[model samples]
Target: TFRVVGHFNTGKALVKATCGRTFNSESDAQTFLDACASAGHVVSSIETKPSTKKPAAPFTTSTLQQEASRKLSFSVSRTMGVAQRLYEAGRITYMRTDSTNLSDVALKAAEKEISKTFGAAYAFTRTYASKSKGAQEAHEAIRPTDLSASSIDASREEQRLYDLIYKRTLASQMADAKLDKTVAKISVSGRDEEFVARGEVITFEGFLKLYLEGTDDEDGQDETTKDMLPAMTEGQPMTRQTVVATQRFSKHPPRYTEASLVKRLEELGIGRPSTYASTIDVMQKRGYVVKEDRDGTPRDYRVLTLSGTAVQAETATENAGQERGKLFPTDIGLVVNDFLLEHFQNILDYNFTADVEGEFDVIARGQLDWRAMLKRFYAPFKETVDTTMEHAERASGERILGVHPESGAQILCRIGRYGPMAQIGGPDDEEKQYASLLPGQSIETLTLEEALDLFKLPRTLGEMEGKKVTAAIGRFGPYVRYDGKFVSLKADEGDDPYTVTLERAVELIKAKIEADAKALIKVFEEDETVRVLNGRYGPYIKAGKLNAKIPKEEKPDDLTWERVQELIEEAKNRPKRGRRKKS
Candidate 1:
């Protein structure tokens, strides 16, 4: 026997249950259901309530990146870069700010702009308090320098981001939106289960007229919240519709995105507004985490009955063009995280990091001495580091798979200097071979079957002109080798080099050879013997150690000795490249 609890939103429902007694067999559940068949049940009560949705607070550094990612599909780095450029160009105010408090001047300008553009009814004179724990009150939230400047000469990306800032700033000062919330309760005829239905209708748009803040949900918002319920009374008669019983399994927590990670860091008070972008940048550069394009396929599917037959129909797939950017830990990342967790638990602990951040904040506020805080933290940290260096295990991430079937060699997965790699045989063995794992494949989850498949590489693809041609996976991807030349296989269109036929390999090799042979254009008739060649950067003339680009009007083949001499002379007088001095 079991007890069931349910919560509903409009037509949507979520059911939860707790087992009262163990059922060894299906007959036990059936016997309990038979006993409860004669019991009576009915709708007890239905209620309606009014709710209000306040306008979102002005965008902080973290919130801006989060919204830009959702609405503009911009990366954290890209958003910050564009914002920096905008700030320098006087198109916007300082972008690296945490406080949501608007300046009196900016607030007055916003009121005028909102009243003039959206009418006086849309404008509301209100102050938004910053909810961030340790936000810097001196700096205001991101906003435009001039509210009346509706257009700017900028790139498309800059214009899109500027518009988002403008709308959000204007909307932040708007009135709270009014909503009519309705909730219904229906009890089963024979069971004690009471199902609830909830819905909300927007009575007043208010700030929604200007903007609606984006959510972290992959599907954006709940559709049930927008749906209206049928006219229900206190004890209305209810009829049973088709029942759906779905079996679902719990899912692990989702991986973090750049936006979500920034949000988390801000929430934990781990970093300040100016450091969020740099922290994410350093992580990516060090290859601790990678921004991977993940498939955002939802789990919900609809059921349609046709001619007494039930058919499952899937909803339309979303995030088609807007591929979700998810951060995945690489093998090196996993190793580094594990090592830190084992040896430096205090440093890696969330609460410890947050507390340290609080100490920094105290120092900034002049409530605590900076040197004292450092002394308190550094002593134990140094001791721990010194002790851990002698006892920590090597973070090689090496594990043994079963032996190979044909060679009887032991297969091992390990993190090499470059990346995670699989090997057949050991260093002591005479015939040891190594292969890199494919992108997205990890050493931890790679199976023996997959490892064996890597050994089939470096496959011979017949001979060409008395030279052996072979296909192999290299550090830079798949390639075909012939004679002394290596030809890269184009796998962009789903072509696999492992299964590429000899004919295709020969074609690719020939194409590469032809391309390499076509680089030389002509030799100039000069004492310096300047040679003109077609290079990747375009046609250019090389004279000894110096090189000069050929003009578009003058082709490499059409260049005369006089033209070559003039180009070389011109290149000699050109300014040399140098590092820019800081202002």
Candidate 2:
């Protein structure tokens, strides 16, 4: 059944309003409703104030990387690569920078562009101070060398990034966006309960005409607050519609994305603008972190509403904790981190890295001796490293989960040679079971049930072609093994070896069969192992343990038995790389 709380009207279409706050309990909301009904609600206070939003500073290196990631879905390295290309092509200024200050010539160009394009009224010359102290990196922020070229002759990513840099450069010199913000407070006469409504009206477009916050446009505006409140005086009586209190829990601090990690590192002064992408890349390469996209889990929440002294409570579900290209630490990363924290406590501190950076800067300016700095850092660092090497136990990052219900064996998760995995027995136990952890599961968060699920793989899905089809996790990842061939599960499709249905497995098997059929060129009567096949780099001969490449001069289809044997022998006798021929 449904009930009408109240009707919402589209007012002047100039602002957006948030009506009520989430209540701690349903009774608290009910009590507020009783007060509203008994006291009667009225506009107790109202204020319309002039507000002006200043245009943001021009693109700095870190800002460029962040905005590109958020707006264009480009990774930090990809953004840097594209920016480097733009820089080499002489399309933009230096890609690497930590400053927000613009050059006089660039500032003049920006002002001229703003004046000619958006009128002289919109032009406002200004300089921005950088957040970083002693920031003289390349002197100017990242911007287009040619302001006239709104779009660059480059790839789609390059053009999009160019447009962002261009608009930001122009907007930095443009006028502030003017707005009139109206806020109203509704009071209950019987009690001290009140509700607040906020509305905003754009008095002047200013820089917003070209670029809004976080987004740039040559023409129309991005979506903004357009539901302006109706005219109401302080003494004017207001009708009670409804009071809603949603049950919301405090969220954990969000995990860092590649861009956010760079930002955080910058805040700590850990790395230079040029090093952020490389550092993050190294972390991923060394198995310290992984970037992944994940679907959020559904969480049930409650809502309590009061309309004219009637209170009702209901539960609802919402997808929560969805992650896209977010970086998460691996088990090994955590273990290594713990080891470093335990043994090299002072060195692992982020401030230590930042202070090292500061020392580098001081040395660069000739204010400090480089040799002294090295001696100071290396002596203590070397001593700690040697001490740890000799005394510290190897960090396997092992965590003991509960015992197995059936075998009474201990269940433990740790970093395995292949990756993170779960074990069914202790180190002293002779007989034990081991299963590779699924790509999505982690040692830190894996539960007993999830760990048990890992062992459930290699399960027979069903029979196909009179043979059993089973799904399992291999060193390469999850796969569906059918008959003698293996069809790997698709990561992008979110296929799980554990949950893959027989029908899906059969479909994958057929697809693999069809693909193999297309790849086969010709079979040889000379030998069963020797056959012609089409591969990624064109046609090649598969002979037993070795592959012989077909020369461009000889057509694969026209190759004779004698030529095939000669090619195979040539491939076999060819000296392997790094081996010297005997004199």
Local accuracy of candidate 1 as per-residue lDDT tens digits, 1-583: 2222222222343322222343343344334334333333234676777777777877788899999998998989999999999999998888888888888998999889888887888788777777666776668888889988866889999999999998898889887777887766666565554556666788877788888888887644452256566666666544433232222233466668898899999888788888898999989989889997866555442222111123232333233223458888889999889888888877888888778777877888899999998898899989998888887778878889889888888899989877899999975788888998887689989999998887788899899888999998877788889987778888895557679889898899888888866887897455635788788899998898899988888768888888888999999999999989999
TM-score of each: 0.80, 0.86
Best by TM-score: 2
Each candidate: what lDDT?
0.75, 0.81
The residue ranges of model 2 lying beyond 4 angstroms of the native Cα positions read: 1-22, 215-227, 460-470, 482-484, 489-514, 522-531, 541-549, 558-583
lDDT of 2 by residue, 63-165 (tens): 8888888788889999999999999999888978998988899998888888888899999999888886435565579888988777767888889989988
- Stretches of candidate 1 off by over 4 Å are 1-44, 219-225, 239-241, 295-323, 366-394, 427-431, 522-533, 539-583
